[model samples]
Target: MTARAFPCALGAVLLTLALAGPGRAQTAGPSPTPDHMPKPGMSAPEMADRAAGRFPQPVRVGDLPGRFLLQPEESQPVLGRVTGLVRRDDGGADAIVRLDGVLGLTRLGLQPLAWSGVGARLVAVPVEAVALLGEYVALMGMTPERLRALPTFAPGSATAIPPGETLRIGIVRPFH
Candidate 1:
């Protein structure tokens, strides 16, 4: 794939990560482990907070093992929920999800995440029911069958997918 085939929007997601906010105060969160378990069917945001140790249950993103999830738009679960729908472009139907109802990305702290000069890079993670788009990716729509097929591993290990390491769960770019 000549880098261009990947999509401009997608390139932007990576740039945002490289520029992730210094992070608030760097709370003394739980250290990663190798025996973390799944959330037993929790929302992506819920899972993230749990992993962050904000909840009494304290869910660790690293505890998720090899799961497919991005950082939550908002740390505090509010009155809004995430929705996914399909749009027909030309003769093709594309899957789309708004990153937090439009302004979610800004809330996620991706400021000045301008596109990198431009290039192609391969991103890999072990998880199922993942729909990869140009700039962002989604995981809430996954089904049991798909979830079972994903690769889950020990938590706290480098093999684990770091929280906020994955972002743009809501699509915030034009698919061109």
Candidate 2:
């Protein structure tokens, strides 16, 4: 076709699409398999209510190894302040803690399987194995002195300590 005719056809096509948008009612997508999706506002089955006495035993805390301390790298909210800290409470090996929730870093916390030698394997870090980067905490350095100092469990332990003054933060397993 000539250039004039081409332009006219293009304009027609554009007008058709514009008009179709208002005239058509978009259909819903195919329903997913019953087991594959839940109805709106529904909740998935939770672990059985141990307190309800459905079984003999209550949900044991130790059964949930996931409840143990999480490294800053393990949690993604992008910001964590030390919530509760106590050195030598769980013995001389580690500190007990309750890490304050991080900000804007929750999605990052979901990457537990991506943290290792293959697919993010589990890597346990000592309570002292981290530092605060303004709002971002990181595993940067660790020394006995630094551990007992910043990112430490002393008086000000839970207070989102700052990054290294001199110590090079490094990971530490429970044992030496």
Candidate 3:
């Protein structure tokens, strides 16, 4: 087609689409399945709530290990690395995170005591308290002080895993 005719044809198509309105334009495709359809009489928020309930992407315990634990709000977001997953008698799990002592010391505004290596310690963080964002496990609403206050997690000890509890996955260290 000629350049002048091309512009005129594009303008006519655009005008047709503009007159169709959003709802009319979107309704051209096949109807959504019942499971995908929004329930009648539901408000926007209600529909959202219903939709959220249908799909729950649970983070598996096996997948927790070796992933970086992030506290995004803090200046140093990379708080630690997940060492393992501890399973409780109640069927719940805790993420064993070996926190970076240097970051902790800096967060608390204290200098490191030793120059050789920062004294990294393990802490058990409830899996429920964390959300998996891509490759990172994000722990929200937890401060450095709060994290420090948590009792250290000692693996292979009676106190670490009560009689019935077990360590489903243990320290996943990267080979140098």
Candidate 4:
């Protein structure tokens, strides 16, 4: 597959993840894992606070392992929420996300995010919202069955899907 295939593949996966589920209830909080401690800078209690969504920086991709997928034009620093998830039979899962902010290639230029939600299909960020670079996005290629997953809210929140056994699809760009 070519480098551009990444986005197309991820688009299908996002659709799958967005629509997956047996209509389960959204879990309220995260479960604790004693063995998994916070990153070096954070104290134990500080980690706990981060898990509870009390930290100053809510979305820290630095905390996640492995290289995440993003467009070449996309900036290194990004902020977003993993909104949807679906467990695959093979042990892997799919996920949908929303990037709240990002810096475009040129300092003066700003790009908008394209999002496909349950109600809103694939739509680009409105001109008004483009200044914020807020875009609803989707991502895959991570095991959601593991204890500390990439898109989980806390250690073990009800909505949190654990890391799966494998990545069915390699990381690629979204299908435009």
Q: Write the residue-wise lDDT of candidate 3 on 1-176 in tens digits.
A: 99889999999999999998776346677865433222334443453354344333644555557888765442436878888777655655667887767546744656544442376678887554455556776654244456656787888632233334433221111111
- Model 3: number of backbone collisions: 0
lDDT of 4 by residue, 115-138 (tens): 321111111111111111123222
Instruction: Give the number of the best model, judged by TM-score.
Output: 3
Ranking by TM-score: 3, 2, 4, 1
Error of 2 at 6 (Å): 0.8
Best by lDDT: 3
| Per-residue lDDT of model 1, residues 1-176, tens digit only | 66886787677887898789657765588854222233345564554443344212222332233232333232312212222222223321222222222233434655523233121111222222232323233343333333433343222223323443432222222222
Q: What's the CA RMSD of model 2 in angstroms?
A: 18.5
- lDDT (Cα atoms) of all candidates against the true structure: 0.32, 0.31, 0.57, 0.31
Where model 4 places Cα greater than 4 Å from the true spot, the runs are 1-69, 72-85, 88-92, 101-160, 172-176
The predicted structure with the larger TM-score, 2 or 4, is 2
**Model 4 residue 36 lDDT score:** 24
Ranking by lDDT: 3, 1, 2, 4
TM-scores of the candidates in the order shown: 0.18, 0.21, 0.47, 0.20
The sequence of per-residue lDDT tens digits that candidate 2 reaches over residues 1-176 is 99889999999999999887875365689744332111232221221121112212222222222233323332332222333222243431122332322222333565323221222211223433443333233433232223223332344433322222122222222211
